[model samples]
Target chain A: MADREWSTVDVEDIAALTAVYGGNPARWPADRRAAAVRALAMDGAAHELVVNEARLDALLSMVAEPEISAARVDSVVAGALARLDAVTAPAAAKAAPHKLDTFLPSPFDLVRTALSWLSVRAPQAGWLAGATVAGILVGVMTMPSATLSGAETTTAQAGTAVETAQADVTDMPSLLFTSYTVETHAR
Target chain B: MDESVQPQPRVGTASASAAAPYAGNPAGTLMGLGPEPGDDALLARIAQGDRQAFALLAARHAPKAMKLAQRVLGNAADADEVVQEAMLRVWTGAKNWIPDGRARFSTWLHRVVVNLCVDRRRRPAFAGLDGIPEPPDPTPSAVNVMARQQTAKLVSQALAELPERQRLAVTLCYYEERSAADAAQILSLSVSAVESLLARARRALRARLSGVVQDTGEV
Candidate 1:
């Protein structure tokens, strides 16, 4: 089978080709330039379209190219190099971690150290630990009783009471501190 | 501004030679050379952190990039900023630049410049005022200078009113003198699509600037 080439163009195609490539068919794509030339030669309307488009191209060409200063070029080059440096710096940094960063403690390690310190150095550490264990035991022991009591009361009311208690517990620090300050001042 | 309409120096010809002396001197060299390296070859070197190759590529393409950006952005400062940012991307992304063979490096750079200009236009910093700056004319006669400035202003106004894509197509094809295929690659559009945009843009510009265009006569 012989490959078909575009050897003919319609009015619409000619108009579009002129609009894009300008009035010169030579500037059009190689495959379509032959067809465009043929169309221009055969059709008067297509020729007229080319003439009209040429006027537009002429007006466009008259619009001068903006002048760029040597200073502007220098600035752009300098700025680009600076920006490239900035971008690559971070990337290079990420590729190789900082020496100081390696010496810094991880979050889990920090938590384990604090616990160990408290167990060794703080007199109140045993009391706090004992209180936490008792609280957990009480919470476990009272779960069934609380469930049984809530069966007699509305679950909604029980939930509201639990929320109130939680809020009071959250406010305890301020109350304790205030009373402590008042006692110290009175003394 | 009118003088800018004259042809500019080609990127890699005399300019490349002028920059050749600094090729190997790291402290003083702005760009490097490797036996008349093309855009692709320079880019390959740039990927390896070759400062000379980067400088050579910048020298080769920066003028066209600046002109394209200025046409779209309408301000020299903003255009310069866009080119700077775009070139920076070119440098940073050099390693990742996969040559598709369908589009040239220059075409890829054009797309970068166009995209940056569009993004700059949408920024609130440029809102409310006209983007066009009056061209500095060195003509002795005040009348001729004013006339050129007026014509340039009218054209800039008409161009500024175009949609982003239409403006990009016109900048690439008309101002940059790129072929339809090149413009298509720059705009990331099919050739037919670029043609349609050019058609609509021409119609709108003709409608807006017909009276000024007629009055200007030669322009």
Candidate 2:
């Protein structure tokens, strides 16, 4: 095999041959081929030869096969973007500066502001008068019912009267029993 | 090879170079389309809450990532999943993407995709070429269909048989046309290590493709 009048093969030759047989031979001029052959000869067994061949075929197949559909590429990118969007959504949401809703005053603050306005715009007596009226309204709404109170007092008095009547009856019975016993003993 | 060539943060060119739709202008590459700024800048803008910039970054790099994923996993569907996951990682990390100016953003992106692909390729479902999708056979057009299919099958089979490192090394060099040094950086291997790996891979590939590569004209 060594005797076959070897024109030195090199990595460049492999590359040129790769270009040539891969169906783009025009890219490798003879000089380029010669240079490649020289490189391949010098660099033989240095890289994965079979794998390179396979890769060359794959590359050729890629070129031979029409460019991958643009739609395919679009879909892939769109899909990736969507995924990224989903993954980053929380972080993005958090990173945004506080919104208008965040700046709105609380209920307490609103009430305080209203009181301040009333104090400054109205006469001091008028503001105090309004506060007193508000306080009276709250007190009236929370007041106990007069009917309920009267009913409770009546029930207590009735209970005491009933107990007094029962005590009188119990004393009469005891007094009668004692008098009968003493009179019988004397007879 | 210059030591002064600061590592330019070699980001993946994925979302930044999206290919334009066929009906559109010639302006876009596969992932490098639309309004997304370059990767490093987009990363900066994204950190600053720029949704448009983030979208652009995703558009530019996803295609290349998908393609690399497909090669590693041997199935388009799985590759798609891997790319999606890889981009999700990029989105999360963008806030910290302080550019060191040593490598391109695309290069960094390439590494990310490669790592994801490698991880996914190790799964049981990706065991062999059996799961890889083959091109649909067209009506026989005197195209030597059998021969081409056989050649393609042999090539893919041989590729599948290479050690993962060798396979990746060859892929970056021959398929992607990356320089050895670039491949080394992507694989995180030293240049000499890549060279050695390539040497072994090429030898193995030569043995496997001897008959096919020879007869098919210089493959």
Candidate 3:
């Protein structure tokens, strides 16, 4: 092994060696190919260490090849089919519309469909602006005051007390909305 | 969760009429049970509501998927669960299966299995822990199983001794049978980074397992 040209080894060459023996031991370079192996493992004592590691790696690859039982395959298939059946049958049953399905549109879906309809049936720009103003005015007109009238004061206090009693439900966000685009240039 | 609503396959002998007509095709055994009729065929059948075809597809791919999961998780039970979850995702994604496009069914399944395993590995349950106590030697557990298993266990043990990235590099290469390029893709590491990991892992295994076998060659 003396006079062996280990000088030819480089880090990229070492990388190539690892690539060859790294996953596939079948193609591992010969044991006497120490110079190449040394280069692969960064030379020095690492050369020998890598050789031994490769041998151990070969052993471990043998162990990883599990002997799967045919019976296990059958059990797995049956179990899968059972699981599939469990999931799919309910879905098939649910294909028929329920009472809630008939009456309650999915909120997001309803919003999407309404948006599409509005896009199709959008009014003239002037009408749209007038409608937006009118709707805003109506919303402001219908707004309930926290400050109550003389007779409404007692009722308002009682309502406030009842709402405070149910604290968990009080802070929930309301889902109601109507959208209107603001036209800066037109305004 | 509704047990009663689940499809109940009639147990016992099948009626000639009830058996799916496509079940016994000569090509069935030749395909060695891949997801039914390959991606294109399965996608077509699924579009037509052929649940049996979908079942065949799932049954076909489940084993290899489970094996991949097993390799990643290093536990058979967890592997089984991962396969179940992965197959469920496949079934649910059937409508979106693109038969003629860039999506290869095997690649999709592999991605699903890998993602699920990775997710589970990140969970508190499987995050870094001391090596599981080696099982009772098979009278010869680590040594006699075949050089590959011994190499794998040594490598795995050594890898377990490593920082996470190095261990992942080693496991993906040795246990999962991945090429360095493929491992780099899976781990999102550069090819050079992957090489460094493998080198580190090999050095660790060598240091840990050297001289473990004594004269007369006993472990």
Candidate 4:
């Protein structure tokens, strides 16, 4: 039906259409568009009403769009970033830069390093690992009681075993736990 | 397109231009010209105070944000100031953002610009349409051309006379080429509310401008 000119609109309809859509047929409601065009062409009063609307459309069209300048984009971004620096500067001061290679190795890197170390010192690593297991088992299973009144000789041997175990196992625990415990306790 | 006719920061021509896709760029929705989808990462970078990330986000949205803001405030410098503050908020306030998918970055961006415009608009002295001057000169081409340039102030003043919501609705739906749904999202109103505001606004502006834009009989 919109393909043909339809005389469905009177001047009032023209008034209503123009009020909402202005004079631009391109902007008119699609269903009533052909009717509005026909009214404008055939009726003088309808033409008058639409022309008034069309005039406003033309006037409104005279207002220009703001230019989207690249310079504005750069300025806005720079402004925001600067403000962000101002905001976060205090907290950012606590951490050393992430670029510092000497600060710490990742866990995977640490493990790889240990593996390489052990390969170069295989005899020492074997001795250390075996001694660590032995010390742990001995500590759990038997203790040198500060006093074993009836068994002085056995107590003496137990004391020797405990001393040996404690000496051998200190390396692993201190390496793993000292830094962690120090920081935890410091906090 | 007319070099002879320089327009101020007005709503109507923006709408006319917006009635077509912006600059004939098929991909140009308000957001289309900005960063593509997945601003969550961008916001995360912003949250971490990554300046480059913030810059990336700003480049995508600032131009459109500026246009919307200037239209609302009716001044380019004021709009620039508002968008500056808005972008600053995006920077400083990004840490608080949850980056939830519930709202697009543009939605928040629009809200920020509109809210700033509303705040700035509160201080200005706006008048009603009671004393607008007569329409454009009815003479031929030369007078029309001069009228187009001269009437710019009256046109802006006439637009400023409408209720803020009416003005915003017209700008959003017409000049920005935002759909009712999109306008609704930006303004946080129902789609029907946006449609009604637009309808009322068109009529009010028609009466206000007083046909300063002459008819060429194309309608």
Candidate 5:
């Protein structure tokens, strides 16, 4: 079957082709490129799209490719080598594990790792310490007074109840026993 | 090119016998390989921990990688960092690389560079000025250099304002001169989708830079 004729190519397809492939029809898909070229020649809107896209392409072309400096290349390659070494070193060490090392790390090992990390990252440790102190200070300052006041009030209430009990004992029991004894003697 | 003479890094012993073929160049050597080695072949050697092959691959591809990075990242230092990191990944992952024949090594590498650049752009650590470097002039004419710098600044600003996908499409298609098909692979988009992206990007760029760049039609 023959390829679709130029008259069948729509403006939207032409515009999209222009956008993706730039203003050049030769660079468009081989199947539709012939029809697109014909359409560009016939349709004013399609021509306008190509012209506008060409202007943008011109601006894009003005943006030149930056030169990669030799120093930069060296630096990047060095960094890559260093990274490769760093990655392989651990694997190598793991392959030839120490006789004393266990499959699971001991507490001492964990502590040593933590200490090493802290030594290497002292700033992070400082930040953590500062955060902990700040949290403690904030907690202390913001604590509600109701708990302390409630404890003090309970202590005072207990003391008053004890004194009241002592006063009642002193005022009542001896008189009741004396009255009983006098009644028995009169009988 | 015997198996006993190829240069190997001193760190790893897994592929020691495999590193004997290309021993002349060491890591970080930027000298040309004279003839281009097939990417697959170099990758095969790289999988064997051949540093010379890696060096050759870097020399072959670094300039293009840097160009793509610089365009996407818009800063020399950031571009360098992203490329370096991508290259590092390429190094560490080469042993596991299975060439499925679906994409070329360059395409895969381009994707790596693109992803890293995009991630860097999103990171808070992207503190450098987000603008393309000014074109260097050998003669150092003050007025011409200034005008070019201003134009680059405007273009960079316009590019920065674009949506991430659109910016990527423009960088791959226009700046890097990649075909729509290859760019789609790098962007993980369909060919038509890349076209649509480029169309929208060009429209946006045209609108943003209407009066800035003189459309001489000569370019």
Candidate 6:
């Protein structure tokens, strides 16, 4: 609130402000207080109006407000906390997300678990035994695709086959003939 | 309007500190030494479910909140119920508080209290008008006490008879001693609108209290 803000304030405005705020210039809006005080100092009508309002202020002053009790503040806090606890207990029991996380592992948890197992130091004899078995399996499993079961080519062989197929496609003039030719080649 | 209650000037000159704008204890809870945690920081903690911070905030503010609710509802029990609900929102609804726009936490609390008071007003009062406690008048020794009580009852009754917004404006400005700007902020009205409400309320109160004022011997 500033003095300039009250530049538009007029006599009527002062009277209204006085009727609402009483005779105390201190209680008036800050921006308009100086102007109001100046207005009242200069104007007899508004000053009388404020003096009349102050009498009502004196009359309204007799009402005894309820006394503040330390016990009541305690009671409100106790009552609120109790109610909050009661409500929260049932709510937390139903579908607590934090609790749910304990039962249902997250993707990060799965990844962490996998990494932990991978980082574990296996026995040297166990590693040697595993390598021997894998080498034997690889040696016995190295056979032509036709001899093996359906679609059981090694990864590199499958990739090469895909490249050869794509090469044929590149050489084809149109997709209609290409599909037919590929089907024929498959047969 | 409480003459005995000389409320310290909260609204200062334009150059006064604007950091704390709320009329009700602008600096939330202060401890020894440097500035204590403000309402915003406390709210952040409450949002994280910190019960200690919630209790501290409640203790710091619930008295004023309780008083405002009591004045608005006119029943201690109903006032307690609504203020508690408002405090519960402070705990449960802390996440909903937006930190921008120079918003004060106490303003949020007062808004919740006022809105709750308004909602509570819509329902039929279980106690009705008869429930307003009229102090038992007796004994020559207590004439002063009786007179004050009677005057209080007359003023309160007159206040009750006023329109809802007018009564609220009177309560906030006259009783609570909140500045018009602060009252406007709580009521979500323009400053002039609140002033208009206060002015209208003052006129109604003046008309109603003509006999009472004459009896009080105020020239």
The candidates score, on chain A by TM-score, as follows 0.44, 0.21, 0.29, 0.35, 0.41, 0.43
Docking quality of model 6: it rates as incorrect
**Pairs with steric clashes in candidate 5:** B3-B20, B4-B20, B5-B20, B6-B19, B6-B20, B6-B21, B6-B22
What's the CA error at residue A62 for candidate 2, in Å? Answer: 7.7
DockQ of each: 0.21, 0.10, 0.10, 0.14, 0.16, 0.16
lDDT accuracy of residue A108 in candidate 6:
67
B12-121: candidate 3 lDDT, tens digit per residue: 11211122343564323213445224556665555445555555555556656667677667677777778777776665666667666544565577668778888887
TM-score of each: 0.65, 0.53, 0.52, 0.52, 0.63, 0.65
User: How much lDDT does each candidate structure score?
Assistant: 0.67, 0.57, 0.53, 0.63, 0.66, 0.67
The window of 10 residues in a row where model 6 chain B has the poorest summed lDDT is: B10-19
- Model 5 regions more than 4 Å off: A1-12, A41-45, A89-103, A109-187, B1-22, B25-35, B125-149, B213-219
Indicate the residue-level lDDT of A53 in model 1: 74
Instruction: List RMSD in Å for every model shown.
Output: 13.7, 20.4, 15.6, 18.1, 15.1, 17.0
After superposition, candidate 6 runs with Cα above 4 Å error: A1-4, A7-11, A87-187, B1-35, B128-137
Give the worst 10-residue stretch by lDDT in candidate 4 chain A: A144-153
Per-residue error for A13 in candidate 3, Å, reads 0.8
Please write out the lDDT profile of model 2 over residues A1-187, one tens digit for every residue: 1123335655544643452233232322344445444464456452344245545545335322212343455566667555654665535755676679889999768867777777778869558866865765565455332222222335555455444433433333333443433333333
Which sections of candidate 2 miss by over 4 Å? A1-68, A85-187, B1-36, B126-143, B213-219
Best candidate, TM-score-wise?
1
Q: Find the candidate with the highest DockQ and give its number.
A: 1
Residue B34 alpha-carbon offset, candidate 6, angstroms: 8.0
For residues A42-132, what per-residue lDDT tens digits would candidate 6 score against the true structure?
8888788788878888777777676546567667766776676644432243355556557898876875565455456555655565565
lDDT of 4: 0.63
